[model samples]
Target: MGELIQEFNDYRAKMNDVILGKQNKVINRLFNLDTNCYAEGALSTKTKEMLGLVASMVLRCDDCIKYHLGKAHEQGVTTEEMYEIFAVANIVGGTIVIPHTRRAAEYWEELIAQ
Candidate 1:
């Protein structure tokens, strides 16, 4: 778990450095879009994060799962709430999403424990 956190941080730092240095304009635009997508509109940021977590699980994106799980936790999402999101992901993503769901659950637990 500690290793995972370290890896995530390292990846984030590298991504930030590279994006800011070379792809500043394009990445900034994309980042703004992402930020706007998660901003409060008809739904709260917490709800958006939950949806993001579910989508990440369904898409089998481990980094997305970690990012969304941590963001959701920061937004005060509970462990039980993540389980419910996992249920929805499992239903939509079918059997293949099982492992990803488990991974998301592990990520959620780690984030909350911290």
Candidate 2:
């Protein structure tokens, strides 16, 4: 779990540098879109992050899962909320999402511990 958190932080740092240094304009625009989408509104950032996490699970996107899990944590999402989101993901994604759900839960637990 510690290693998982470390790897996520490392990946985030590297991606930040790469995006800011190399593909500044293009990536910045995408980042802007992300910022706008996740901004506080009728649903709150926490809700959006939870939705994003569920979508990531359904899409089987490991990187997106990690990123959205972190973002959700930042927005103060609770473990119970994560469970509900995982349930939704599992239902939509079928049996294939079981492992991803486990992975997402582990990530959420690690983030909370930190």
Candidate 3:
């Protein structure tokens, strides 16, 4: 998890460097908008994290899965919430979520075991 956090921090820093170099003001404005939007939205950070996980899982984005799962843990999203999200993911994406659900369950089990 520590490694995951460090890796995401590094990614964000690198992405920021590139994006800022290209369009500093534009990127900064977008970031501020994103911040305000998330802050004002009805969904809490944890719920957003869960939704991110669902999207990542459906899209098979391993990096996104790792980052958002870590954030979800940091934000105190429970195992039950994850399962619920997975269930919804399964219903929406069918066979795609089946394998992802298996992997996600294993990931959750490992976390719980620790």
lDDT of each: 0.83, 0.87, 0.73
Model 2, 1-114: lDDT tens digits are 478989888988997887777766878898879879988899988889988988999999988999898898888888888788889999999999998888888888889987
lDDT of 1 by residue, 77-98 (tens): 8777888888999999899999
Query: Measured by TM-score, how close is model 1 to the native structure?
Result: 0.89
Clash-forming residue pairs, model 3: none
Q: By descending TM-score, how would the candidates be arranged? A: 1, 2, 3
User: Can you tell me which runs of candidate 1 are displaced by over 4 Å?
Assistant: none
Off by over 4 Å in 3: 1-5, 24-32, 99-114
lDDT order of candidates, best first? 2, 1, 3
TM-score for each predicted model, relative to the true structure = 0.89, 0.87, 0.64
Selected candidate, larger lDDT, 1 vs 3: 1
Tens-digit lDDT track for model 3 on 1-114? 444356666998798788877877877899777556445268887778787888888887766676667677778778888788888877777787687778677666655554
- The RMSD of every model to the true structure, in order and in angstroms, is 1.7, 1.8, 3.3
TM-score of 3: 0.64
Instruction: State model 1's lDDT.
Output: 0.83
